[model samples]
Target: MSVVNPGDTVPSAKVVVSDHVSFEQFVVSRSRALLRTAYLLTQDRHLAEDLVQTSLAKWWAARRRVTGDPEPYVRRIMVNEFASGWRRRWRGERPTAEPPDTHGPAIEPHTDLWAALANLPRRQRAVIVLRFFDDLTEADTAKTLGVSVGTVKSQTARALATLRIDPLLKAD
Candidate 1:
């Protein structure tokens, strides 16, 4: 019961469609969670959306190799991609006396927490987002970031300490 014709160039069409269905189901169920994590990593809605889209495309291409839950694998891809983008941007960034107005003024979040989060370095931000925002264990955060659990612990500690010292977040 093959869908291929004798002269057809395309083979395994049915298998491809079935695999696509599984991937679609996985995306439907988990996209919001992924998007939230990406937002935490990027702190911008458009970048977060693009990050999730790219991560899903990469995951779909490598779906065959992914066994069991895809959440962790997809998360790892998102973190890596964001970090790569960060590095590229870091290299290209030209410091100016005044910030560029390409996006105009940013609409800051109501709470000071987001502002504090933005102050941390990229890796620390990633660790905090994975450990607290995404609710992953320290070991899992380390795995996602390709670092050791102790590194995750230290980064999380440093991020928390920075946030704690923020004047805006100080008790009234």
Candidate 2:
């Protein structure tokens, strides 16, 4: 049998540890921003949390292969996850006809904008979130969504047009 090379194996083991540390640091630094972006995409706090966790888990699994700024990679994962309509396997909570009462004052100031955003089609919504909320350029948004820049521009234009005319925003 051929002998194993210690030099070849040892460095790779160190690299794995280094990569793990980098990934951990990335998660610590970016989790909040990621959660905010996810919240905008999902429009529900619980769903946003779930989206961030799922995207991070998927990113962690492929961490070694990723290079440069991990934010874009993580963001791309979030966008893709949101677009594909990721849902929980077991939705234990059932919706009630009547809304539950809350004790605290309303925190979100831009409820009308959120409502308008919620009404947008998924692709247009993704474009709006990535371009406006995340502040990505047309080229960058296109790269993240794996679409052409023209598609990003067109979607952005269409979403904005729809939002401008939305009755929810008009009421405000």
Candidate 3:
């Protein structure tokens, strides 16, 4: 039997059967990519992990009803979750005068672009991330966001316009 590694991409030819094993395989193969997309959407690593976990839990609960490729459905869930403002309250830690010590290298290289992206309204930011970062077609982006294709187009246009004039981006 062929072995499937966690990092391996799920084969497109293999149909997703409505079974827990299939779902587990799908999660193992796709979670990293989903985490990356979540990071782009939420702009915070911890939030991104929570977002992915939340989306996956939702998808798992509805797995029996899910058909065809599950990626889009999970993506829709992530976008919806991000847009719904269901965030955990910051009760454990409070900001202090001095930053915490760090020895690890920086995680993000495109701080300027990310900062500019953070400035965008949620919908516009979603459109930009779905269309460009995820390389989804405008129609696919619309379907993921549960909006019209025209809405996706307009949002993308507005986001690009804003990015073009962002001071951080313009400084480069």
Candidate 4:
């Protein structure tokens, strides 16, 4: 049996009763932040876009369950999906090799910052992004990661320590 689309329902049907806000409005408001965070996690613009679309689809499908400040919720979903994809790759015990030359000038690259972020374990990177980029409080970040506040504190210290050697930030 075919599942019915929203418009297929009879007139006066309540597909979304909350504010009657269309999906387009929500996407327009949140796409940039979602895409940026996805890029940071996936490290590829195209992949980041796919990640955001996947996340948004999931979020919209479960729209009634979420209310107020959905950004963190969606970000968490994107991160989880990214980690899941990484696990599916066949990169076991790979050798250290030179990175691609996407770091050349004219990009205004935050090479040090990004390299430092990449060095972090997945959980730590997620925490750092939620705490710093998302400007979420420690308690909120912990909630998003489903970890204790103590874990956030420990992970943040470790990530910042790794970044401290960047030299760009040392003089600042």
Candidate 5:
């Protein structure tokens, strides 16, 4: 008879029906924002959507076991998926390329930074994305990147230098 508030922890329902409205509400409230983070990390709109949806699906599936914030879990999954794709590329197994026409619509603005950023080595691009775009701490960036903190620091420095030297690039 009463509407549930966002982020409210009410009595847990039957395992089958717990937090249905709240979960949907949460998704509706935050899904687009989350997708933006995914897009920044993956740089492919379609892949970003897949990453966000996949992250949400995994979260929904494991909703019960989740004790703390679900956002971080989904974010980690998306990051890991992006990292996995990067690892695959590093291993020389390319994912099947989708022709540009297959994607339904153009959603993001193209930028000079995008061009310069595309020129970065993979590790540096990742360091920039995780550290700056995600606003993650250096320690968290290192953890997400599966590298030493010193590596994250150096990669970020080089990445910033590359961007700085390229006059076409601008700060976000």
Candidate 6:
């Protein structure tokens, strides 16, 4: 048995060192995926970067308790952060000018889909992202959003209904 004192520096090769390394690897391996999810949720590159950074910093501080897979926990942080901010300021960008013609592939199909997604309400957007994009089950989606499965079901139903009727996606 050991009595850890406030002023004592005991061992250097214990949980902290290993946990730090694991957390660093976690950041490297998952940052891109997290950023993509964040971009989908926030619909802005700058905001997505900020959200991912903020979520990583948060998870790092709580690394001790973040055992097993950390992606879900980090995702929960990003989603909650976006949701809270959404409740405050509800605005997103709209591209007015069309993309310049080039010899590359065109992204016509995704444009309408993204536009329709952007118009969804906050909870509905989160529900759609987690359920469809992330491919989490309804129970997992409910757990991540801190809502009931019934709420997730209803939000998904409503969001899908709205998307199905959107003029932009209707032409797709």
Give the top-scoring candidate (lDDT).
6
User: Whole-model lDDT for model 3 versus the true structure?
Assistant: 0.76
Q: Which stretches of candidate 1 lie over 4 Å from their true place?
A: 1-21, 86-110
* Worst 10-residue lDDT window, candidate 4: 98-107
**Model 3 pairs in collision:** none
Candidate 6 lDDT by residue in tens digits, 62-150: 87787768888899988988866542444443334322222233347787677778778767888999999999999999999998999
- TM-score of candidate 6 relative to the true fold: 0.74
- Residue 111's C-alpha lDDT in candidate 6? 78
* Tens digit of per-residue lDDT, candidate 4, span 26-86: 6778789889887887666876787787777778788788887666667777777665444
Model 6 alpha-carbon miss at residue 57, Å: 1.1
Kindly report which residue stretches of model 4 are placed more than 4 angstroms away from their true locations once superposed. Answer: 1-17, 83-109, 166-172
Task: Order candidates by lDDT, high to low.
Answer: 6, 3, 2, 1, 5, 4
Error of 1 at 95 (Å): 8.4
TM-score of 1: 0.74
Which of candidates 4 and 6 is the stronger one according to TM-score?
6
Candidate 1: Cα lDDT at 74:
90
Backbone N/Cα/C clashes per model: 0, 0, 0, 0, 0, 0
| Candidate 5 TM-score, true structure as reference | 0.65
Residues 1-172, candidate 2: write the lDDT tens digits. Answer: 2423213342222223143456556666889999999888888887788788788777878877887677788889988877755652234333342122222343343876776787786678889999988889999999999999999999999999999887666644
TM-score of each: 0.74, 0.75, 0.75, 0.69, 0.65, 0.74
Q: lDDT score, residue 47, model 4?
A: 68
Give the per-residue Cα lDDT of candidate 1 at 101.
24
**lDDT for each residue of candidate 3 in 89-123, tens digit (9 for 90 to 100):** 23333334212232234334377677778778777
